[model samples]
Target chain A: MAKALLLNPTAFEAGLVAAARARALSPAQSAALEAFSKTGLPHRRIEAWKWTDIRANLRDDLSSASAANDVIAPSIFGGLGAFEITIMNGAAEWSGEAPAGVTISCTPQGGPLSELASNHPLANLAFLNTDETIAINVAEGASVEKPLLIRRIAGGGAIHQRVTVKVGACSKVTIIESFDGVGRYFSNSVTEFSIESGASVERLVLQNGSDDGVETALCAVAAETMSKFHQTALLLGARIVRIESRIALGGEDAQADLRSASMLCGMRHADVTSQIDHRAKGCTTRQLHKSALKDKADGVFQGKFLVARGAQKTDARMSVNALLLSDFAEARHKPELEIYADDVECAHGSTVGALDDAALFYIKSRGLDDAAARALLTEAFLGEAFDAMPHPAIERTFRTRIARWLEAGK
Target chain B: MLKIEDLHVAVGGHEILKGLSLEVPAGEVHAVMGPNGSGKSTLSFTLAGREDYEVTAGDVTLEGENLLQLAANERAAKGVFLSFQNPMEIPGVATMNFIRTALNAQRKTRGEEEVSAADFLKLIREKGKLVGLSDEKLKRPFNVGFSGGEKKRMEMLQLALFQPRFVIMDETDSGLDIDALKMVGEVVNSLRAPDRGFLVITHYQRLLDYIKPDRVHILAAGRIVKSGGPELAAELEKSGYDQFIKAA
Candidate 1:
């Protein structure tokens, strides 16, 4: 018998590995786990994990996963009349039946796993080790009137989950994903979206993790001809949070709109990264990100647009703006564009500054005290990201989140 | 209604307003004219309480109250308004919303009731017409995409709405055509009252031809070098401030 090796193994890691091994695993999956035992989890020493010290965050040694019976309170979106699905400790539970024209099932195969298995090590590990995948499919020409809500809750140990969504031709739907937790845990999630030709999908992601929890999410989307994909993400704060998006405009006349707003305070860290590829002609992509950092927090934003050859008439633009409220807070931004087509219109800009003195004075000269003036200005700054959202309910929810954060700061 | 006694100011270590003194009684319009590089703008901004414009000496008072002891917003609530020469264009702020908020804020500070939306709408419409600004202009972001003349018109509109007891017009007619200038004059003449005063700062005599100031003072090297009646404006316009500039 080969003895198990520990590489900076925390109690949490040991418990997660034991639970995963007890659940079933193929020979190849067992071999991959053995390989992971040798190298252990990646640390800040590695090039890609320099800013986020995952190994240090997992220093505690945990033994068992939190019980499944631990109930979570209602979500902030509870009043939106959405069809709610709860995933507790990586297990999906549907309280109500699926809406008409929509089907839900459990699929272990057939997803983005095959496409991304070899490119990214983390994706491969997550696909091979996760218990199951929840699949949602919409029939062709079907329109879903109500939004779908997916809530993920985790505690005590590490949990990885995946979601696959497919929208048929000419279909329309809206999906919202909320990540929340209260204990010391790590949640790694992946969501794959496929939009068929002439389909439209609007997606919103809300991440408000506990101070001790760490969350990382990856979203990969494929767009067909004349299809549209819009995504807006709002993150309050986390110990180490990262959200990555990779979108491919696979057909002509496809369009994508990506926007995000983040508020980081204390010692929290948040990163929003995106890469958009224009592979077809006459495709358009627009991206905007805004961050507000106070105290000793840190924010990171990196965006890139890649236009391939023969992709003429490609219109793309990206901008990132950040506001720093204290001397110790920091903001890092990088906007890149790699264009090979001669007739493309591509541009990127980034700015980091303190609040404007003139505007502050103007607002204060009204009757608002200094604090109220600051809150109002900060809201106006971040509110621009949700300008294009069609649903007023979701927009108002995001605005309320901003207001809550400001109140907590005070 | 407003008084400045030996107000000395400096910017970047250069003294701009050295021992400058002036007084505006209730219901009076005072014009300060001088050559280039005079300290007229400095006086207006300092009174409006802009940061970094150091007040090295003396004091400013309004209605026997020490204006120098208050912040910019406090002074504004005390009925002091400055119509900037070049108004700032805030990209995402709505013009109508900002105006209403500012008005309500001032009222709230003075223990007055908040203005209703219907009342605000009616007031803006009336004031917009008096200032020659169309309804479409009020729908845009605060001053965004507006020309210099249009920006001046916005200032006039704010003046008509706030109705402050003391108003400082800093080169309010810099880029206006004859029609716009006439409209500005009409707004000022309509707002005139026995309890309110106006300080119109200008570089030309044409605007003075419409508003008709009671006294025109020459500011040179941060201090007043000459004071005269309305004819003094035409004299300086024709002969220029060559004598005043040399004397300062």
Candidate 2:
């Protein structure tokens, strides 16, 4: 009998380790990486990874990293005049000088290294091997009028990246993270945000990956008293992609709203998993996820709300809706609510269905052919997820991406 | 003009309209009275090109063009409208938007220009008032959370809006009160033109009292068993469909 050998780490982990060593990672960071290396990449054996086999896709041992050849065009958010930071092949590049009231540094202290090492084994391995982390901090009581855009571009070999955002007390800020890449490379990323009391932060994450690339993003957010945290994510599917968001409401009256829309075509796969924990009383959380899957694509949404015993009067609601365009397309939804407080109100609902025939007939009767009618209805359905976004620019960008996806799919 | 010759329809392998036939020339109103399960609704659904109802052996034509050869929306574009007995409530579809889309689709299919947004808004508002639907009702999702009477009024509003060449009202009076019934009569009376025709299917004669029919027929076992003038409706109301149910 030939024994199966788990001979090599994924290309992403190897590249990340080389990048970290070149940056001369600290002893603590090195130790964290060593611990992460033991577990390696998550495979189909893991319950959460059963649907998307990231390990299978990451089997190749990547070569040494080089500068990606493709030039990244301006972001869809270019008209917003955002403060832009570009990361090419896991290295950070600033367009110009950093803006006032905001400090940007290269460090590994405040990101999701510990969280990744403790919770997700694969993310821990990526963090262990990754080099520098982009640290962004907003000054106390500072109001950022413009959005801070972080663009991550990867090509050829694998890459690992990390980002940390800290919003000081009473400050307001918005951050937009856009991930685009080429070639067959693996990209692993972790983003951690610490929102102080009375602070408000808005975040938008856009991931559009190549057919051969595998991407994973782990986001951990901690919110303080009276703080507000809102995040909207749009994903154009990859060979295999998973985005995990973990939000902890640590202060009274803190609120968190998370919304995501995903469009997947061909044989691509996309999964969005989120967990919201309420540790204090009077905290509220609202989550909505919408996905449109076509061809043989698969989309997954898993959301959980955990309210501690003393977190009384906690209100949390989650809804996940999916539209399957083709008969071969698949969608899986798991919404769970764990509430220990007797006074809390928690509810969750999930639905997966094809477009309504009656509605199609009605739309077609009005003037649209089958294709036009289907596209219009689909856009309207997914548009509901981003309808409540506070920033018009962010909402419009998301809408444009959705339209582009529909148009391209056609 | 619309014509049905030797129409035979079967649903779920069971025959409904067996050799039934009727004709309505332009500028005429024909009423069909039948007992429950006498295939009244099935006839309307078949005429509207619903998928489930099968025409085993029949022929229907509108202005000398084959109606069954066209798709449902195509039939709509060809000026065939059926005011459903139970109007479907589609969540997330705006009432005014759906109406405008359907109207423009019909117009576009017939090589006409699309209705501008401002023009559509004004037209719907005017027609909505004529059908007793307030502006607030039109702003809501299509028929969502609407009362029975309001849903019927919505159907009337569509009728007044589309003004299709051939209109089939299947049990439109089933759920309406006197006021709603009067509203339906007013819509039909307004849309009565030299080039338009109507087929009103009802169980009660009260509706005919509001909008007088040129001819009335009694349907039994999927076939027209008797035909007469306006007095037939009064006679059916006086004596019930008990005799036809036994004969059918």
Candidate 3:
């Protein structure tokens, strides 16, 4: 019994092993399962997940069965008129026509895990359990007029999904992925994006989970020469949620922009972490994160930029700020830069504090009650991160989400 | 219209207003002249219902309503406005939207109908021009990157917009030029009403030259040392608060 417990420390892990044994697994899936066995689940003991202890939060046997099929809410971004792809309960489904110069397909077997996911436990778990892999490809030198919407909705139990997007050379496409779920469940997903030379991809994510759900999404991006990748995410935390991104600028003159905001209340938690690797010269990256926490909610942000020895003249800056509305609310931020090249310009800043007393008084003196004043200030604080989004309708949708959160807080 | 009886206020455990008492009747503007550290701004903040200004012993009433029992915003709904000596630079808050929200909030609390957006835009544009603020300046974030005079202009603009029952101007003329001072006087003169009252707290007599006050009081050592007609302002301006400080 002791040896068996050591092999599978958690009931969730035991369920995963049982499910894998019931099916014929590919070598990659077998390797991923083997890697996941080394560490049952990331906890406080791990340096990378000190503030977000996943093992401590999960208790039940999450791998028992998939979530119950329910009517999914319409996408908040339905007005964008994008080609819609819905993935529910680890199953991929779509019926719309693909956009011009774009091809969408799904395969029963997922591809091998990339280097970023090779060592990530959660990403490995998602890869090993995914039922199908969805692929979106845009042809070279093609500009897709409409956007691409990937709506991932989940409910109950455990669910894992995977998606890969490839933008051909000089192509442009906008992708919006929204994560929504209901009831108690564990939703783990892994998404990969490959941007070729001179290609551009704008990705927007909106994650709002149920009060009892646990979600973890890992995105890996590889950008070639002159490629551009921009991503913005708004996360309203759940029981426990983590959104992590790893981007590698592999060619000269590549650029990436990452921005995210999280507003959490009650006992919910949210973590937004990113690691950007500058491997080539003249690459630029900018990242900003904002969070507003109230009650006993927790917010975490960990960002690191690594400039290699050959990646001279690299430019990168990161700013992380959090506002604690209640005395019990907590925020933890870790920003670091490791540069082997002396000519690179990289900097990061973090600040965590309550609302300004004078500003609150000023707003109140103008006739807003305490709650209204706080909500207004909090909205303004988080609104700055969404100002640079290119799509007006998409921007309004994010703003509307923020307003709803504020209303609930009030 | 406003009355403070034996008000004793403390800040950070130190008494700032010691047994101070004063009154300003309706349909009149009263000027309170004082040197630095004379509790003029403390009185303004206490009247505006700032949380930091603790009223250890006092009775403040506006139109016979107990102002001490209400919060800052409640007092605002009751028509209490303070033009901050140093107007805050609140970034990311649009100027017009914020003012409109405040206006609607006040109107809602008073059981009055809210002003529509188009009507508010027109009103603000008309009043913004009255306070020498252009349409372009009114479109920017609240007080962001504004010059000192422009911030004062914003204060005046709000003063004109709210048109509160009781107004407290704390050093509203400290950083203004001649033209801006004239603008301030014009806005105040336009808002003066028979049922409304004003308390202009200042260090100099230049602001009084524009909007003539009905009475002037000398504040020293957290109490009113002298009270007289508007001529008292000119007298104190020349003689200064040295004698009054010594008497206290």
Candidate 4:
């Protein structure tokens, strides 16, 4: 008998192969699967995924499944009257009148996965499985007053979504995404942001999923000259959730501000990992991440600032803070800087502690009970992460979500 | 309106307040004076229901209500307040919002109506002026970046705002200057009423010169070894706790 194949095929590998068999693959899709078959699911052994073991967490065989329950929940930011784009289980739908200077369309394919993220298994998976993509383009020199909300709600099964957002030169836009799901599902999403010169892009994300859900979001942003990319996210962690950001500054005086707050209770887990590359001179980046956890939950934050050889006068600061409300809660942070430039200013700080005893005593002395004191302290820590949210309505939603989580914890 | 009987408290398994006993009748400010290591802070913490200080044996009451059985917040709702020796600097908490929430919480706990925003702001502004604090200070995060004197003034501000029935001032005069001392006296003197009471714990007799006390008790080694009038503080300042520490 011919020697058996040395590699034993896993369930995910077999499923991925089956998915490829049922579809007519484009060249890029074929290349994406070819790259994924070699890498398969990312395990804890992978450096970038050491804290998030997607291989073990997503072990379900990806057979065909039905759509999610079509229960439409009112938007939390409904009062602001944001233009809503509902993407359910990879199928996109939007109705009603479109706001001025905002254009939305469905495209068969935008482009191939970025060369820098081609090695990422989840990125490859998103590329291989995404057949229809959504493109939201803000025209050059146009200003959109209202917010654009991409409310991605999914049901049970696997979902792969790819969205491309291009903010034209001298234009401004605010976009918010909510990753909310029901039962067990694996979602792989890739969002590309191309911010042109003199443009401003404010993006917010809220991730709240079912207890058995596994989700990963990859954000790749490119900022041109004098462009600004500001991102704020609040994650109420799923069974396994990873929100990763990869940004590259392309021209002079570009700025990027990224912030995230995560609250995890029970046995839930969350990882907010980001890598920002300063490839141009006179660029500035600021990142702040805060997490509050109770029970046996875990929160992870990994941030890296990379300045290339010619990227001088680059100033970047990063701070990661955590509040562990219970003894069993765990927080892990790895803030790093890889600088090859001669003149650059970069600083990072991290702290992980429980609520301050003195502050608790002070609050209680003023007639607040233990629950109120803890909730206030937790909010004080997590609230600052969303303070710079460009939209007031989005900030309010984040605050309400955090309050609900804290109440549930209590 | 406050009374304590044979209070025995332990800190880190060591008895700090051993068989302590004292009483502050309503409408009077009672001062408890002692030297270092006399468990003065422990007494205040235990009285305020700090969880770290275990009450092995004791009974504390406010207006005949069992304060010992209640949490710190419950004790406050029952009209007991403690001006800590060192007020905490809580960053990221809006000063006005925190005070408002605390006031409403106490009201809600007592089944009283919550204060409206305009009413609360009006009350806080009045009390803030009484404590020699400006509106700018009230707008900042609670006590963040405040000087020691400003922190004491903040305590006084809360004192005037809450107007609790029974108040404990633990060494409130330690970090104050002449003006701050007078300000504290003015705030406390204004809040003094027929139904209110004060328990002032201090090291020197300087504060007694301002907020006159009806009774002065010498607390040595966690027990009141002597009780007398305001002159008792003058005597302790002249001689020292050496006499009482040895007697206890």
Fnat, model 4, is 0.81
Clashing pairs in 4: none
TM-score of chain A of each: 0.91, 0.93, 0.96, 0.96
User: Where does candidate 2 chain A have its weakest 10-residue lDDT segment?
Assistant: A1-10
The superposed Cα distance between candidate 4 and the true structure at residue B10, in angstroms, equals 1.1
List ranges where model 3 is wrong by over 4 Å.
A1-8, A64-66
Which predicted model would earn the best lDDT?
Answer: 3
Residue A391 accuracy (lDDT) in model 1 = 92
User: Candidate 1 lDDT, tens digit per residue, A1-410?
Assistant: 11248745766556546665675766555655665555455567875556666667776654444643365667989989999888887788886678876888877633446343324445545665676788899889989988999998876567788888888999999999998876777888888888899999999999887777777888888888999999999987688888878888889989999999989899888888788889899999989999999998889887889999978999999989999988899998878899999999999999999888777765665445577668777877888898748899999998888888888871
Ranking by TM-score: 3, 4, 1, 2
| TM-score between candidate 2 and the true structure | 0.91
| Local accuracy of candidate 2 as per-residue lDDT tens digits, A103-157 | 9999755444544234666556556556678889999899998899998887867
Off by over 4 Å in 1: A1-19, A27-48, A62-74, A107-114, A121-125, A154-156, A340-343, A365-368, A407-410
How far off is each candidate at the interface, as Cα RMSD in Å? 2.2, 2.8, 0.7, 0.7
Residue-level lDDT of model 3, residues A1-410, one tens digit each, is 01123444777667766676566778888777777766777889999999988887775687554576665677889888888898887777788689999999987765887777668989888887777889889999999989999998888888888898889999999999899988888889988998999999999999999888899999999999999999999999898999999999999999999999999999999999999999999999999999999999999999999999999999999999999999999999999999999998899999999999989998998899999999899999999899958888899999999999999762
- How would you encode candidate 1's per-residue C-alpha lDDT over B66-182 as one tens digit per residue? 988787777778888888887877666778987898888778878899999999999999999988888999988789899999999998999999999999999998989999999
Candidates' RMSD to native: 2.8, 3.5, 1.9, 2.2
